[model samples]
Target: MSITAQLTDSVKLPNGAELVNGFAFEGRGDAARRALFHNGHELEVYDLYEVFSGERAPAVVFPVPWTGWDRGVDSVSPDATFAVFSGQRAVRAVGSDGKQLWEYRHGCWGPELGHPHTGDEQEVCRGLEHGSCRVSDDGRLVWAHVVHGADEYDWQEYWVVLDARDGHELARLPLGSAASGSHHVSHPDGLHMGLCIGMGQDGILLHWARWDGKSLTSWDVNEGLDRILMDVHNGLEGFLTVEHDGADLRLHALDGAVLAEGEPESGDDENPAGWDHCGGFVDTETIIASTVDSEEEPDRARHWILDARTLRVRGGISYPTGPIASYARPLGDGTWLTYDTRNGTLDRWTTATP
Candidate 1:
């Protein structure tokens, strides 16, 4: 399958803060303008917020409560009515008006435990090195990798399922922790989700879960694995990953099976600086893979589209270079998005919708 997406629209971020990874679309049908954007440090939801559509100034902005010392599981609900903030110590559900709905005491950031690592306690747990949170599709449940920091040596991860409506505990399973903060990817199936953790020397851990009506079922498919997840396939359950510090891009199944694997084309004797470490599934069939600025090519990162089924390069797409990081964010309508931080603009690239 050859993928061709054309640039059709662009929007300037009103806050001027750079986007984190990508944007989130909430609500359904005509009301889907509510978009969730990450301004690096915090996730903000905007009313009338479809940045790709016609120009409509954000009516209001709701910022999540964040700790200067810790990273939280950050996202908004599908309806854009409620915001979920899974912080260092607790998870708080806030309303669009920026009022707290309820709070659940989950765990502590290890620095507060008075341990030492690469940095100070506060400095060590600076980014999302602990745990994170996400909401279900119907806005009924919340999934969390709740970390319980016991000591510098024994931090445990509680695979938690929560009631999104009332902020109550639904179920908790101790996924005997390796690293504290593992990033989670949501599935359209609602009952499914995946978590990927990258522990520097300890290796990578991949987890997949599904609610089987009675309880949550999980799979830690890290046996004999070396790469951390670079992206989740657009299908919601599989993955697109790179070997730890290596250049081989792999497509894998939820059960840890490598479906297809290869690296971006490069010249011989060329020590390519590796990928800009970005890209993702454009749809059920296409993966948008890109390279970061190499020492050899600092001007721009190369963008390549891949067939998710065959893991084959379909074609290459183009976008104006950016200052922060070059990336491709597929919008799932035979189109993808790119953020040119240098010019502070968001662009939508699409092929004729099939």
Candidate 2:
């Protein structure tokens, strides 16, 4: 069961736009098709199809207050009307017109504590520690992770949900763990959000939460296992995860049952190759993953197409356009993306023969 990969389109990033997440695509198909590019202070919203055709003009743009290095992760609303930034000190919502819509303050992610010197941006500038923010599918809520002052002397990590319209705090749950940074993976159900918190050498923590309009409920998943939650299956049947060390890849049901597991042979009897955290479900029944971390040279790295239902390796993706970067991101639309760092261009790929 082998599938071939072919390059379809390549678009150079517009006007020196340096992106944090490269490009964040919204939905699978044309019904709700959009992509967001954020580079610290500005966010540009583009139509996914237009981007494929080398369209350079963004449909909308939002200007943020803090610089890129001072922030954790930022996201834009599905409607492209508001952009939320998770900064070292607070979560801010900015409008498309470059105005501050609202802000929710929290304990600083930086080490500076206790005393209020001056509310200067440089106070927490260049801090390595941070959190992540994501807009809900409905555009009614904002899910965020932040450092909170439990009291004057103690600070705790908390996951909070905010009213997107006004930045009002609606619900919160204390994470009870140290975090270096985290990312939110939104479930297709719109009510559920999966959070993966990176705890550095302490390993990884994965949490799942649901916002059911009235209340927020959360549960810790992958307990005792150091797995990094990667992506939710497009059908919402199960999600993808790879071990923190990339030793094993697993697919789990919504209730946290491991449906399948895969440990690719590294060709070394002792050291098995592991999948990197860079891939995802390419479609309903297929997965595209990478093993770049296991390769000493980036040029020698390889990407594999796996059976989404069973985690079985099907074959390697053949690039007709020569070599791709070590990482490939599956867009869940039967296509994936790779970046050419040399020319700052993004190349889109799909199967040359189906």
Best-fitting candidate, scored by lDDT: 2
**Candidate 1 Cα outliers beyond 4 Å, as residue runs:** 1-5, 14-34, 38-43, 47-49, 66-70, 112-128, 149-154, 176-180, 230-237, 293-297, 318-325, 351-354
Question: What C-alpha lDDT do the candidate models reach, one value each?
Answer: 0.63, 0.78
Please provide TM-scores, in order, for all candidate models, with all chains considered together: 0.80, 0.91
lDDT of 1 by residue, 1-354 (tens): 434456687777654332325335433223353566655544566653344556555544565566463355566777667788767667788887778888877556554456445433233344446677778767788887776655645567787888887878878878745664566776655567777765668777778888765787888776777666665533455677777665678877777787898676643465564654556666676777666543235465567777776767676554333232446665454556666666777766666454
Query: In model 2, what are the clashing residue pairs, if there are any?
Result: none
lDDT per residue for candidate 2 within 123-185, as digits (tens), equals: 654357889999998899999999887333588999999999999999999986788889888
Give the Cα error of residue 91 in candidate 2, in Å: 0.8
